[model samples]
Target: MTDNIWTYLMVGITFAIYLGIAIWSRAGSTKDFYVAGGGVSPLANGMATAADWMSAASFLSMAGLISFSGFIGSQYLMGWTGGYVLLALLLAPYLRKFGKFTVPDFIGERYYSQTARVIAVFCALFISFTYVVGQMKGVGVAFARFLEVKFEVGVGIGIVIVLFYTVLGGMKGITYTQVAQYCVLIFAYLVPAIFLSLFATGNPIPQLGLGGQVTDGAWLLDKLDTIHTDLGFKAYTSADVNTVDMFFVTAALMLGTAGLPHVIVRFFTVPRVKDARLSAGYALVFIAILYTTAPAISVFAKTNLISALQDKEYADVPQWFTNWEHTGLLGFEDKNNDGKIQYYNDKNPDMDAVAASNGWKGNELTIDQDIIVLANPEISQLPAWVIALVVAGGLAAALSTAAGLLLVISTSISHDLLKKWLKPNISEKKELLAARLAITVAVIVGGIAGINPPGFVAEVVAFAFGLAAASFFPAIVLGIFSTRVNKEGALAGMLVGIVFTATYILCFSVFKMGGPEDYWFGISPKGIGTLGMIFNLVVTLVVTYLTPAPPVKVQEMVESIRYPKGAGAAQEH
Candidate 1:
């Protein structure tokens, strides 16, 4: 079959499966809507958790980022992977033992204040919305190329599909659908990876292929570095970013992963604390399969892209190039009126001589980094089915996370804001309606943001993680570990952390306030969340000491969740 036929076939099949699962598992009550009736098996929940955790940023953008940034981009790999470990070990079990429907539910009751709950709900909404923008963008990119539609139209399509499953099934439908998505996405990722690995290094395993020598008998990394330096870019193996900024970015991502509300709520779907831990372990294994292979994919994709396109005749370019160009994500301009392309680091001063000698006007090829993974199979001349499968996988990764995030947004409004705070006596049926309504609004808003994002997929996701790290991480950690942290401390800390981080991001990334020279303490907006987190911790600690401690019952509740003895017992709110 042609690529278009295969894409339509595969994507249609996957979407049908997702919709079928949603129909089969649609929630009938508030409990089912919020936590899948809180009876999910560990294995199923683990698969769902893995799918939820691996968003468009992980499947589509991480490898692309790593390919361009070289060793400096390992921060994303390290931070995100390390953060999952942190979440599994430090947060998941305790939160599950606490037996809350959502993070805000935990914070409100634990702090003994409706005000604290409201603050957490706000933070959850902000973080989830920011994160979903990346997913929406991923959806648009995939649909734009494979489905042959405008990016905005693609986003609108995604919003409708996600809204259908998310609103109808809620958490119940999302959980089972994610389990299927995990299979699709992982297979989609690994098949192309294995094919590229064999083509490049004669190895079937991508991990080993990364270290193996290429057909030219040179180590893959060494060859990549040569390619990069020849193009007037930094060596692919070298790290040029500041060490402090790297550390901060890594730490923020790690902390943010632990604090993400969507991931946290997954544990609530399971039956017991032990089940939560087990699911987390299973999720780690599933997640590592993709995460470990990412760098190898990065190396393969980068090497293949440059080899196929650099200085190539524009008229003779591959069909994939023309296909992607139709999406407006890839373009080539004959700047020097030379029919050949010039893809290089034009900003590098040392490349000036090279450009002049070669009669290169400038870097005339424009390739969005987000397209690398989607374009990898075509660049490597893989089969049409493989290319189509990748499209499905990318969509699976995107829609799975989008559903999870939209659920969080809806639950925050319907569960936290309306039911818990505004109208404690609201009917369960009315609350369910409210949740669906809230998600409908959220999907539209997220679709618009996807059409007009502030940055690349991974960069926008990093900002969301930063916001989560600065705001929710401190509050949750202190609430779990420190009984003395009163509502005042938690409330003040969350407000300060999110506000400061949001302002910093807005100034640098949104408003174009100043250059890197104006950064506070030499930290970029992406890494400033670490500083905000620190401020939150310090403020939380100081306020706890200055104000009265949490009530005796709240302190006892903290102590109860820490121990595993009675973790299976149901706790009263």
Candidate 2:
């Protein structure tokens, strides 16, 4: 069969399975739609949570980012996975014990104010929207190749598929679909890695192969560093960023993982508080399987890319070049009169002599970092079936995370806004209807944002986590830990945290007025969320001391959430 036909058949089979699950598990009431009636098994919930947490960025963009940035990218490896330990120990059990249907529901009652809930809803929406844009990037890249359409058009197609399953099935359907997705994505990721590892180092295990000697008897890292430096790029094993910038950025991402509404909500789905803790352990293990292999893949892919393409004539470029170029991710121009392709860092001043000697104008290749994983199989010359499977896996990552984000958006609106305020008397049937409509609106909005993403998939997701860490992490953690923080204090802290973080982002990213030099204490926009989180805690504690204490009942509720004894099932508060 033709490549396109094979892609269509493979993708069609996965979609069919997802659709069947959605139809069979169609939510019957608001409870099912919101939290799957709160009876999900721990193991099943762990698989689903792993799928939900590993978004398109995790599946596609992350390894690519690492391949380019080298050892510094270990920050992502540490930040994203380490945060789950915090989530399980500091956040998950208490949140589950609270028995609320949504994150904002807990904020609203624990803080004793509708205004606090409204703030939380806004935080959830903003973070989810930022994250959805990344998912769309994955959709665009994966679909564009198989369908032979513009990346933006592919995003539109992905939107329709996600909407069908999400609006039809809600949390229950998504949970099962995600379990399947985790399986697909993990398999797709590993197959090529094992193949490449064996090809390069005569080792089938990627993690060990990356550090082993290649066929030429030179260490892989040593060879890569020598080649990379020759091209004017930093060594793949070197750390080149400022220490302050690296620490805060990594810290923000780690804390933010615990605060994100979608991941946090996953803990609410398991059967009990103990199940929540166990599921987190399981989820982290599943996630680590991909995390550890990615850096090795990054090194392997980068080595192959340079060896294959560098200094080669433009006329002799591989077919993979044409395929990726058609997607607009790989760009080339014959800048110099020379017919040969020169893919080196032209930005380095030391390269001026090299360019003049070779009669090269500048770097003739432009490749987006996000394209690395999607292009890996082809770069390594894998079979057509493997390439098709990788595409399906990319879609699975994007659609699964999109489904989880849509749930957060719907719950924030239907439960926190409409039922809590506009129509306190709404029935379960009506609430379910509102949730579906809210989901439809969210998908449309998310799709629109994806068309003109603010940054690459992984960068956008990092910012989303930063926002979540700054805005929600402090309040949720404080509320569970201390009864002294009143509604007024919590509200003030969230407002300040969000505004401070957003202002910094706008200053550097939007207005372009404040450069990194203008950033506080050498902290970049990526790490500003750490400052915001600290600001929140300080403001909350100060305000609590100055104001009257919370009511005794509220204090009792705080203590109840903290203790593990007699923890009940998750319920619609």
Candidate 3:
């Protein structure tokens, strides 16, 4: 079959399965809507958690980032992986034992203040919306190329599909659908990676292939380094970023992963605290399968991309190039009217002589990094079915996380804002309706944001992680571990952390207030969250000492969650 036919078949079949699961598992009550009736098995929840955790950023953009940024991109791999370990060990079990429907729910009750709850709600909404924008962008990119539609139109389609399942089934539908999505995305990711690995290094395992020799008997990484330096770019194995910034970015991502409300909420669906722990373990295994292979895929794709396209004739370019060009994500301008492509770092001083000698006016090829993974299969001349499968996987990764984030947004409004704070006596049916309505609005807003995102998928996601790290990490950690952290402390800390981080990101990234010289203490906006998190911790500690301690009941509640009986009972209070 043609690529279009295979894409439609795979996408249609997978989407049909998702919709079927949604209908089958649709929530009938507030409890079901919020936590899938709180009876999910550990294995199933683990799969769902894996799917939820691996968003568009993980499946689509991580490899692409590594392909271009070289060793500096290891920060993403290390931070996110370390962050998941932090979440599994430090946060998941305790939060599950606390038996809350959402992160805000835990903060509100644990701190004994509706004011604290409201602050957490705002933080959750802000962080989730920022994160979902990245997922929406991923969806648009996939659909635009494979489905042959405008990027905006692809986002619209994604919004509709996510809205259908998310609104109809709520957490119940999303959970089971994510389990299926895990299978699709993992399979999609591994198939192409394995193919490329075997073709590149005669090894079936991508991880092994990364270190194996290429056809010409040179180490793969060495060849990549030669290619990179030849093109006037840094060696693929070298780190160009400073150590402090790398540490801060890695720390922010780690803390952010632990504090992400959507991933945290997945534990609530399970039946017991032990189940939560088990699911966390299972999720780590599932997640590692993709995470470990990412660098290898990065190496393979980068080598293939450079070998195929660098300095190639524009007219004689491969079919994939023309296909991607029509989508507007890939372009070649005949700079110097040479009718040839130049893909290199033109700004590099060392390359100036090379460019002049070669009669290259300037680098004339434009390639969006987000397209690398999606276009990898095509660039490597994989079969049509593999390409189609990748499109489905990209959509699966995007939609699963989008559903999870939108659910967090809706739950914050409907549960935290309306039911818990504004109208404590609201009916369950009405609250469920409110949740659906809230998600509908969030989907539209997210779709609009996706159309014109502030940055690429990974960059935008890094910002969201920064926000989560600065705002939620401190509050949750203090609320659980420290008995003296009062509502005033938690509230003040979250407000300050989020405000400072958001302002820095806005100034540097969004507004372009100054160049790299203006970075505060040599920290970029992406890494400033580490500083904000420190500020939050310091403020929380100081405020706790200055103000009265949390009430005796709240302190006891914290103690109870920390040391629950029988691997912690999972029944909600």
**What's each prediction's TM-score?**
0.99, 0.98, 0.98
Q: Write one digit per residue (lDDT tens) for candidate 1, span 151-224.
A: 77888888888899999999999999999999999999999999999999999999999999998899999999
Candidate 2's displacement at residue 392, Å, is 1.1
Q: Which residue pairs of candidate 1 clash?
A: none
Better of 2 and 3 by lDDT: 3
- After the best TM-score superposition of candidate 2, give how far the Cα of residue 461 lies from its true spot, in angstroms: 0.3
Q: Give the runs in model 1 whose Cα sits over 4 Å from its true position.
A: 568-573
lDDT of 2 by residue, 1-573 (tens): 766677898899988998999999988877788788788999999999999999999999999999888887888888888887888778988999898877888999999999999999998888888888888878888888768777888888988998999998889889989998999899989888898899999999999998999999999999999999999887878877788988888988998988999988888787788888999889989999998999988998899898888888888889888888887878889898677778888889988888878887788989888888878888888888888888888889889999999989988888999999778999888888898998898888888888777678888888888888889998999999999999888888888888898888778865778777788999877788888889988898898889999999999999988865767666764
Candidate 1 minimal-lDDT segment of 10 residues: 564-573
Residue pairs with colliding backbones in model 3 are none
Candidate 1 lDDT (Cα, 0 to 1): 0.92
For model 3, the run of ten residues with the poorest summed lDDT: 564-573
Give the winner by lDDT.
Answer: 1
Cα deviation of 11, candidate 1, in Å: 0.8
